[model samples]
Target: MLNDLPIRKIIHVDMDAFYASVAQLDNPELRGKAIAVGGGGARGVISAASYEARKFGVKSAMSGRLAIKLCPELIFVKTNFDRYNEISKKVRHIFHDYTDLVEPLSLDEAYLDVTANKKGNPSASLLAQEIRNRISTEVGLTASAGISINKFIAKVASDYNKPNGQKTVNPEEVLQFLEDLDIRKFYGVGKVTAEKMYQKGIFTGQDLKGKSLEYLEDHFGKSGSYYYHVVRGIHNSDVKPNRIRKSLAAERTFSENLSSEIFMLEKLDHITEEVVKRLKKSKVSGKTITLKIKYSDFTLQTRSKTLPYFVSEKSIILETAKDLLFQEKMSNSVRLLGISLSNLNTETSKIKVLEAKEKAVSVQLKFEF
Candidate 1:
């Protein structure tokens, strides 16, 4: 199984503070100043903060009031997703110039398989440098990249030197690198998992590798096998492109918690419009409509209904979402509302299955070494 894994050249590209940087670029006077791109209200949460704001411990998902208190001079700018999406498109275009196997994790990050690239480049490191330079020159923003033999290591390496930097891990150095890595820094290990690992005497990759496969599986369940192989540098996940998106959602947190069901119905009307517009843009629709609500106390409730056929019409989605909302009893005053569509069209479903099959077959193919 280890011999079956192919050594593909993968590059992970991540934009540095994308929204905040874009805000700075568009407003020259905001450059070098502590700024956050989010709402400036008592109930508002921050979406992104510039590096300058980091000095004062400002961070994303932080309450606007606390962020302001941390950085007294912090400038708050509203999010401009349309503008950010435009820039993201340009960055993706640059990526396709080198390889077709580009998997975008978000508007700001992607994984690219460049082992057999259109550029005929021999070094993934050089390719990363060129890509970063192009982004800086053309988009007026900086990007960081990491190059390695697989997606897992590459994604982790991308953050080694951020905000316009790159790192390359040669195949020979892969194992030693993993052995020295801290468990807390592992790609998928969240805070809770890391705490559990520390309690188990698993502090680094070497410590994780010391455990037997059966022991790992018994302790961590299905995720046990993942940690076992990753610690040994055996991740074989592909950099897949054109994968069908499972769902499309649009949501908003209100400045004030609303008590009236009538007001929620009105809000759902607008949320449905956003979801429908996004569905049309993606040229896809779903049969499942999910209504998500967050109460003033921060508890969340989701209700979903699946239709016999996919529908992207605004009226259909809005009416269906309204039904889902009213069918469930409100536990408290609502502070957030969202709508999403899933159970996608048949064609997309088939495409996804076929892609998975192809990936599995590719992974099973024997490697040269």
Candidate 2:
């Protein structure tokens, strides 16, 4: 059955602890020590943690205070996005050397389709190694990779041998590999979903495969069909090179909670300005303006207004945000405020032309790499 599907060579490359690794690379003293990037203050959250810190149960998104409680000797470092972006570009340059079909998931990871590569190399496994080698030598960082027949398997396999390692799931190994996989390891299944799956006795891919499509749909809704097909190695989503941005937003977490609407206006004004600047930089506008509010109790609320036409000007965005802010009374003191624009004009005629050209490319069933 798998022999009938078109096979493409896909590789998922992920940097090892990117933010913390970068912090160590620039400062030699940070190497071999447990260091965390960001989350230095009383109200701070960790952005990333070094491997040494991981042993002490410290990780990204963990609160700084909690991280310190876990590892008292842990060091905190500031985030340098500019340096991270600079290094990301260098790594991307290495990817373009092999194929133009690179889709960046983030600064630290990406998906590369090397089915028909510039190198004319038949072995995708070797290509992955070459890319990882270049990143370590040229960029002074370590990376891990997963090479496989599709993006889904490739993504999961990348984490199999982490921290400067690689894994390849050949066409023949795809089925058994997926069957043995734990349900929690499935990309889209989060903690809540995993617990629900556990209740249904769907602990592994094989367990999930035992249920009928209707049963899965009845239990998991739209995601049910996805599980049914993926367990059988039937994921066909393409490695999209030009992923469109769905929305743009700017937000701030205030030092003190504001209890009055009058105090929120000034903060909203600054957020609106930042939103417009980003919209102009991306050369896109949107019809929907959403105001995100987080109360001191940590509950969240969102108020949105979709205009008749797209807007990018600060005056228009700020006015719309002001309207939403006062549309209803404050439930409690606000701790965070955000402004966002969606329904963007990014899907221009150029993207349509590219889609048309993409459809003309041919597919092959036999595995080449």
Candidate 3:
């Protein structure tokens, strides 16, 4: 039935090593060399690392000190948030030129539903290639795109190529593509789950397809159904223009700006705790959590991460924010702090089953600072 059903074309576009690659494009000297941006002090963590840096085993979230040890000549640069935002806008504008069915996952990645595109190319893969080219030619940054009949397949295809690459997966080829893939390649499967699948002898999609849905649900909980469809190339997920959010956030401006590091931490503790309680009350774990800090100089900086797992614990949420704050390095005095969570989904919602061990729905807690 899926083979005969009318297809909805989708394209997933992602900027490669987004933050670091943007840095390289802006600074010619940094090209082809190991470079990292953001909180680079003794206690700081690498926010973004260039492909060159990755080659030296440097990585984002690695301690700055250790990153330097890996690539002694690594160039550590302070972040230019304004610049990145500017380029993000430009890149988004380019996408809009082709289709309005665009959904931004972040400043760097987006899902474009081109079921009916402006250029009227009809072929999703062709449009994907054109968009990739437009990004490189217009924004001076390389991008990768995956085009397919649905959201899941397109996302998988996009990553098949590296910087400035495009991949297309149609209905017929979808089965083969998935059969060769490992269990961990599915959306929700992480390191721990992958190992569990391996022990269950589900080394590939074919192995996973052999198990019945009932068995998978019995073993993997609510996620069993999700695993079933993915391996069979039967994803029915939509490329939402904008997924509705489950949480709302508000911030108050202080009459007077405060500047004590000790005081800031104390305040953040309460704010983050309150946010966590709200999340639990909703019976949700936000995959995208944002931490906002404003300085006396009228400047603001925020960091966020989307985790593959969900959690509702106060201690875990607060600790993550605390890590980001220290990692970002407070540049000046503080005026305000705000925390918001989005990308929330119901914990017990049913989804496709990929493998026997791959169906547990861990509340996706986006690991953002």
Q: What's the TM-score of each model vs. the native?
A: 0.92, 0.92, 0.69
Instruction: Give the lowest summed-lDDT range of ten residues in model 2.
Output: 356-365
Rank order (by TM-score, best first): 1, 2, 3
lDDT of 2 by residue, 311-361 (tens): 999999999999999999999999989999999988734563354226325
Pairs of colliding residues, candidate 1 = none
Residue-wise lDDT of candidate 3 within 1-369, one digit each (tens)? 466544567789999988898888888989998898864765567889988888999988787889989999999987776688889989889888877667788789898866655676667777778888888898888999988777787887888887678888776777888888777777678888789889888888888989999978888888888888777767766555544556634343444566766776777778877787666655677666677887888698888877687666667667777777777667887777887777777543123222211311222211110
Predicted candidate 1, C-alpha RMSD: 3.5
* Model 3: how far residue 47 lies from native, Å: 2.0
Question: By descending lDDT, how would the candidates be arranged?
Answer: 2, 1, 3
Off by over 4 Å in 2: 347-368
- The lDDT for every candidate, in the order shown, is 0.87, 0.90, 0.75
- Candidate 2 has an lDDT of 0.90
Comparing 1 with 3 on lDDT, the higher-scoring candidate is 1
Model 3 scores worst on lDDT over the 10 consecutive residues at 360-369
State the lDDT of candidate 1 residue by residue for 190-275, as single tens digits.
99999999999999999998999999999999999999998888988877776668989999888889999999888998898888
